[model samples]
Target: MESETYHGYNIWGHAIQQHEEPHRPGPYAASGTITQNNRVIEASGVLGFFDTDEGAQQAGLEWARAWIDSHG
Candidate 1:
């Protein structure tokens, strides 16, 4: 996971590798979260799955930026 602070909002990239799940074994999914006042305000689930960690992270970051632009 990676995190960044922008405009007082904390954005996080959640990229987890699925090790045992039959549906997505050995792959990663991109999700995003937003935190304000040290609490999570928005969290995403399974935005998309990717073949590489970098791809997942990029998706998460892009999603987060768009969300922040609309919500912040």
Candidate 2:
């Protein structure tokens, strides 16, 4: 938790919420593209994911699996 290195990804999605709590930081990543009939929110973050593009895509897909449970 002590480092100057910032790790993350540059993706796109649709943001649903512009509201922010007072003195509360907004989400590290906001929805860039809301797919799945708006049921799925694609918020992007590093999460210390894969190093390569292919790996990151796979990582994103894997992380997306959780949305099924939340939306289902």
Candidate 3:
């Protein structure tokens, strides 16, 4: 999980590990959440999957930033 503040709102990026087969790690799921004053503003379901956890997290962050930009 990673977090940052954007436009006075708190944004979070998460990477959820997945399993594709027995004893094998699958891609990471990207998700994000946005909050203001500790109150939930928006939360996204899985945005997509990526090969690396960092990639997924960055995708989530990018999605969150775009959301904020469009919504503002």
Candidate 4:
């Protein structure tokens, strides 16, 4: 999980490793959440999947930032 503050809102990015098959590594699922004053403003289910954890997390963060930009 990674977090950042944007436009006075807290944005959280999450990367969840998935195991779709045995003896094979699966993709990482990306998700994001936006909060203000400790309350959830918006959240995403699975944005997409990526090969690396950092990639997934970065995707999530970018999604959250975009959401904020469009909404604000």
lDDT, candidate 1, equals: 0.83
| Candidate 1 lDDT tens digits, 1-72 | 888887788888878887767787448989989888989888888888888888887788778889889975
**Candidate 2 lDDT:** 0.35
The C-alpha stretches of model 1 lying farther than 4 A from their native spots are 20-26
Per-model C-alpha lDDT, please?
Answer: 0.83, 0.35, 0.88, 0.88
Better of 1 and 2 by lDDT: 1
Q: Kindly report which residue stretches of model 4 are placed more than 4 angstroms away from their true locations once superposed.
A: 22-26
lDDT of 2 at 13: 27
Candidate 1 TM-score over all chains jointly: 0.81
lDDT of 2 by residue, 1-72 (tens): 111111222223222232345642433223222244334345545433222434444444444444434545
- Between prediction 1 and prediction 4, the one with superior TM-score is 4
Clashing pairs in 3: none
lDDT of 3 by residue, 22-67 (tens): 5544478899999999898999999987789998888888889999
List residue ranges in candidate 3 displaced over 4 A.
22-26
TM-score of each: 0.81, 0.37, 0.88, 0.88
Give me candidate 3's TM-score against the actual structure.
0.88
What's the true lDDT of residue 2 in model 1? 83
Model 2: how far is 60 from its true place, Å? 0.5
Candidate 2 stretches greater than 4 Å from native = 1-34, 38-42
Question: What TM-score does structure 4 among the candidates reach?
Answer: 0.88
